[model samples]
Target chain A: MKKILLLAGTALALAAGTMTASAQEKLKACWVYVGPIGDFGYSYQHDQGRLQVEKELGDKVETAYLENVSEGPDAERAIERFAREGCKIVFTTSFGFMDPTIKVAKKYPDVKFEHATGFKKADNVAIYNARFYEGRYVIGQIAAKESKAGLAGYIVSFPIPEVVMGINAFMLGAQSVNPDFKVKIVWVNTWFDPGKEADAAKALFDQGADIIVQHTDSTAPLQIAEERGLKGFGQSSDMIKFAPKAQMTSIVDDWGPYYVKRVQAMLDGTWSSTDTWEGMKEGAVVLPPFANMSDETKKLAEETYAKIKSGEFHPFTGPIFDQAGAEKYPAGAVVPDGDLLGMLWYVKGVDDKLPQ
Target chain B: MLEAIILTVITAATPLLLAAIGELVVERSGVLNLGVEGMMVMGAVAGFAITVSTGSPLLGIVAGLVAGLAVSLIFGFVTLTLVANQVASGLALTLFGLGLSGLLGEGFVGTPGIKLPSLSIPGLTDIPYVGRILFGQDILVYVSFALVLAVSWFLFRTRGGLVLRAVGDNHVSAHALGYKVIRVRYLAVMFGGACAGLGGAYLSIAYTPLWVENMTAGRGWIALALVVFSSWLPSRLVIGAYLFGAVTILQLHAQPLGLGVPSQFLSMLPYLATVVVLVAISGNRRATRFNTPACLGAPFVPDR
Candidate 1:
């Protein structure tokens, strides 16, 4: 059954490819969002990138988008719809869309599919993600400097490597400043839910965490921190407006440059399936203006940011230990991209368990 | 620290209590409306939109309640007049609500909302621990408590309550006795809708104070389950809501408190508690049968 299905899929893909090849029009690109485009978080950032592509590429390429596409079989339909609508390139902007994107790509071999924060790739599928951990490291330094309670809070979304790495990087960053610095992790197991995220922030605060960080994509945690007169950082987008005085700084995902670059590659006939993970150096991740911190802390954050941007430092450098006190990376050894992309265990100072 | 935990627990529980209390009344009137989740999300989006436009959290809450009531009317009309399957109609209502709320709330996304301020009774609010818990809560918290009392009194202490109960226990007999069974059920469903709307508005206006797609999440379903877990009792509904809320809040703090369990099990605490408590409560067949509306989910044709 599998072999027959594969052959049938290949035949259908070939048919679709020839049909697309027959049409000689402007390149049509499409984007699928897991949340509404107005979420002001992950999806919103992706939409911004889409707009940037249109602005930079001009009439050479036309773009379209479908927001709030749930991940699963539903995502497969959304991606396929873009293909049927003559979208040469479709960007699935969520980790949960990985399998669906790959499946859709298999049936539309001529169409290029780019998935964000995902690991899987096909002949026509590309994977791209920002090294958000790089930004997390910088914020960790600021948290260490400003936190009077010495303990920080991390409101986590899932046990996935992407979220786990952010938690580890944040703790490592804090530990770099104060070796005895501790972090408390509260896993809400959801990517977006304002109420749950706010409650998690309160729970962390009640447990003596003066500074809060979140891997989830809502500004609720930051808002709660602001209301409680505490300090925290934002996720995905710059959320200084939401929490003003409470936000130390936000780790903003700047995907506009990367989006434009990829479309340019497609237009130039140089597009190919590749894994792209870019950080501050590549302008993929940016930290908004530092605020609500002392001048001394600001200088330290600026110095760290500059170093990361200049490739002078990597967040996962050397001598790392799991929560069980087991050495995962030896002294002076930097963690490989594959390891960072698939991180599963917590760092030594994270007061939480990694669910299997 | 304890105060902060208590505050969060109250915030989490209030929405569940509000939605469950309304559902409890509906179920008592023999209408199995599974559309609480749908009504709640509709309320959430409408509430957020109104609050954003009018700059008044109070008006936003009212809009949410109206939105929920409006959606419930569709379910009531279909099941009551058309004599449709209550279960199927309820499920359709949920799907409709989720989709429409997403469309309705499209433009309101990412906008910062004004939080409903807590009631500060001056001197009483200044009394440290006692003051903050009792007096520092928002107006909705007090309203929820009053609802529990009002519903309790209305259900067990009034002539109207007996008639509604009779209609639920045996609709055919009630209809024969000229009790207007369908009318009674419709009123109960609308009340349930109003409460759910208020719960959803509270979520968007006070709890998180922001609008996001699917902001109500699965709290409406949880509220529905809470109705059953309370064995259709108004007072027990409060206990169930708080227990669920406490478990949800504590699951996050479990690791910080150094419980040697895996975070996955801790994360499942609320759901696990729900299942365990539900099974235990439902184990008593006599008690279960006595509390449950005998004609629940059954189509009632007054003419027949």
Candidate 2:
């Protein structure tokens, strides 16, 4: 009887070992999103990149995602759970997830982690971001050329350096086209509240802004622009459908190629902790076809797009002035990435004060 | 500029008024339903989906109302019929509604909605400043005002209203008097659900004219707070809703004026105003006690 029990235990252990071996054949890549995938804005675009990984890599990879994960302490628990569940590589996609990703990476040195739009890194955690302000520069020029009032309504989310940087870039772009152009800024203090965003847009338009711009994620502002028979720019994703006649152009975030490349690196055992910030030159940022504008404006926008893509034009170059009329950078001087990443001041022509 | 601001204020206030008025009815019957956010979001998704499929904003509004009613029925069954804790069940209902609506609205995201057309009383709508503010609103805005009047009249003047208030004040005595306590509560809950649905439909179909996950965006919670801010009086609800709405819109306009105040402080103004006003009104203890439902949030089970 003892021998029979021992033989049965041995057989069970062997079966369990074989199941684990078979499961290890596929690499597990997971993602954590700050908002619902149905937002059709920031998180939705990130989800599209995850889908691209599955399509490009096929049967060799297994993917999983947790959406609407709050960027508080809950983020740490979510990332830790993925690591414990044997996720070979976990992508924490949000700026607020930076510290949490770093905290989890310290514990799981064997597992690779990537955080988006963050500026932190460790031996096991890599940070990646797109130069969305590059596209913002192009749209600012378009706003200046197309606006009859030479004023644009800018709806922003938070006072983060990323948002502040985008505001300054936009001001520079508009100034490049028409130095006397102005913008009225409203900070809604949230990333994705549709009603409040629409209210902000209406208030800006009522105050006499002819063109609308938003750094927040939602189609509400654009839909309002369409209703008011005005023009606006789309964010994060191509929202031409939501505001066909109103959308002049959209700064589309293309994270598919980057996601695919990173997943492949994990599969090839070439994963390393790196800080990557790429823009139009590397196809990380793209602009859809310009519409609702004259040919002259379209040509100018395309020319700027080409110049930025070819590395011939840097949006932050030369003669930059702060809101207090202090010179930030002299002519022929390019702003460093470190300065841009930690930017806390607004440019000369922004009509609103930075929250500091 | 004044005309445009007023128009914007009306659009912002209508949804809060719609949801608060219905919740006022539910609370009057002694049942505290905290699922307003859930019900409103369900209504939003249903309204947007139906409107997109049928291309009729009117039908979409009806569908939204029905959807809210249906979800409220589930709350009615769990809390009233099953005698579960009303607060826990209501919170669960919100979680369930938010999740289910996300699933139902997955495909409808990014789809443009057909805006509900505004009423056009030719001469009235075209007048200088007051014209568009008064006559140019969508039908739901008028419905919200009419609902306030109808609910106030029914609660104050009708015999049915007396029994409901009685049931809320003393459920045991009302049940002993042969009035159906659970039945009155059920109908009141359903009415609240339908009103919340209409408010949500207005958001998706008329206000923004698009569908996104959680599009109600905590408006239901604001509606819930407005009920308390009104001291349980229906007429006072309009004052509270519009006051709250006005502060919200005014703050947005204030941000651009470069008031030198942090945007965070501006964002907190609406909530700070709600708290201060609530404290001021709640100071009149007699009026608050007079309208307060004695048996509110307590579940009732009839003798077997």
Candidate 3:
């Protein structure tokens, strides 16, 4: 009887310990945004992903976010605060947050860090970016089919590889429809400025562009296009409400599934650092229902989108030429991911000089 | 293309001209309020919010002006009444304004705005090159020009203007002469705030016709630089503002116009031009001595 009582006590103590451990397994997640959540653009979309994590995990995970956190030193502090606050996983959502995330990850090696639209990675830091160029290519097809002047104007923030890839993909998609299609680029060197973006749009409109494509985060370009009865594509989030008549389609960023999956991995103790670049196939970049287009154009856009998803159509398929008419890619060959990731030159039909 | 470019240049220049002209008067009265950026952003948010709610750009402009004035009064009380350091106070004002505007403008983001219509002068507006510029501008454009002319005439010609300038040139002497130095400074600061507010309203209503955080994009700083670049002269302020505007607009067209230089260099045109012009203007010591307010950025204490 004495032996049996001792064994029962040991079993009870072990079960109690297991229960306490499970209770402490509740995970804390944090996100750092580069702009105010009300931007209704880039930051807004990222915030939605944070919400998705909460919804998916319910009581198992708690999430928080710090908005309008500028890049550089400020970002490092914000990330560190999350780590110090007992957050197990932190996601820094902006390309500029790359180094800051890495720096903070080094100090808090146990904290898992996920950065978006960045290339750098460490043991504790995982980089993820959506193939936004894929969405740009789809929109470019729609713009080409519907453009009255066969001229599209692109308003970009910087000449980074990501932005350059979007421009090249857009032009390539347009060229597939109209071989003589041309694109004029105006670099604003800012991510969000409604006034400047609007001005750029008007300037491009005055220069005879009927379709405007923007890599910057603002509804101003599309709104300006709506005001002038022109068409454009939205960036970061769906902006159809802001420009119902003008938005042909928007490159809606769906970071929800990815965020939920990452949190799940962390919870299961199977988290590992890796780089993820998912496009339409992985559902990172989604397109809204086609609008401001004819039935035929919409059908064609759908078909092209499916082809991209199925790996049948690639935007950077060779024979590609640089702006200077030099062949960069040979015929019947698709550009490799390594080369596309570091693209800096504009395609042949782009009239702007690549700023070194 | 030339017509379009000119139109864009005008739109860009008007806000800078308005803000600079206001700061010019404030400096002429012997006070340096570095809160132009702060006040302008306040105007932007207040203007955008009122316009979005009321659906009237006119009321929005008024709210912007009043909002800017309200913010400037805080600076006025701090620097003029509390005798705080002008430079530090102004910097604090900018930080405050940016933060406050971001908070206030949270709800106004992404909302479509009503564009203030341009003034159509019938037949005169139809004339090709010079017509749209001189006759077909918006009401605020004319207001900006009128303010410049009015300020120029007021500063150089009127007795009141002389008293104001006297206060700026030498506050102690002006106080000895019973010129009400603090009162004059207060009015000058308020006027500067109102002008900056108008410039901000012009940005949200007429410039972009929409609201976004940090939409001023350092235009207020550029305006401040223009005041110094123009040697505090209202007429020169116009030249500097337009030149800056022209450079900004032309940079966008450089590549299309077949200029083979990199876009980054083109992007730096306005700022680089400002530095070059400032250096050239500073080289002439006589001009600087003649125009810079003797009491600029200096604290004044009136002894009863």
Q: Point out where model 2 deviates above 4 Å.
A: A1-24
In candidate 3, which residue pairs get closer than 3 Å at backbone N, Cα or C atoms, i.e. clash?
none
Candidate 1: residue B204 lDDT (0-100): 91
The TM-scores of chain A alone, one per candidate, are 0.91, 0.93, 0.91
Tens digit of lDDT per residue, candidate 1, span A1-356?
01111111231221111112122378988888887776788888998998898788856887777776777777787789888888999999988899999888999999999999999989999999999999999898899889999999888877889888888888888899999998887778888888889988988888889999999899999999999999999999998878888999998999999999999999999999999999999999999999999999999999999999999988899899988899989998999999988889888988766767
Q: Which segments of candidate 1 are over 4 A away from where they belong? A: A1-24, A319-332
lDDT of 1 by residue, B72-146 (tens): 999999999899999989988987787678668877877788899899999999898989999999999999999
Docking outcome class, model 3: acceptable
Best by lDDT: 2
DockQ of the two-chain complex in candidate 3 = 0.24
Q: Write the per-residue lDDT of candidate 2 for residues A110-215, one digit (tens) a residue.
A: 9999999888889999999999999999999999999999999999998888999999999899999999999999999889989999999999999889999999
Off by over 4 Å in 3: A1-26, A55-60, A310-312, A319-332
What would the per-residue lDDT of candidate 3 be over residues A252-317, giving only the tens digit for each residue?
899999999999999899999998988999898999989989998999899999999988888788
Estimate the lDDT of model 2. 0.90
Tell me the number of clashing residue pairs for each predicted model.
0, 0, 0
TM-score of each candidate?
0.92, 0.96, 0.92
Residues B263-294, model 2: lDDT tens digits: 88888989999999989998989999899999
TM accuracy, model 2? 0.96
Report each candidate's C-alpha RMSD, comma-separated, in the order given: 5.6, 6.2, 8.7
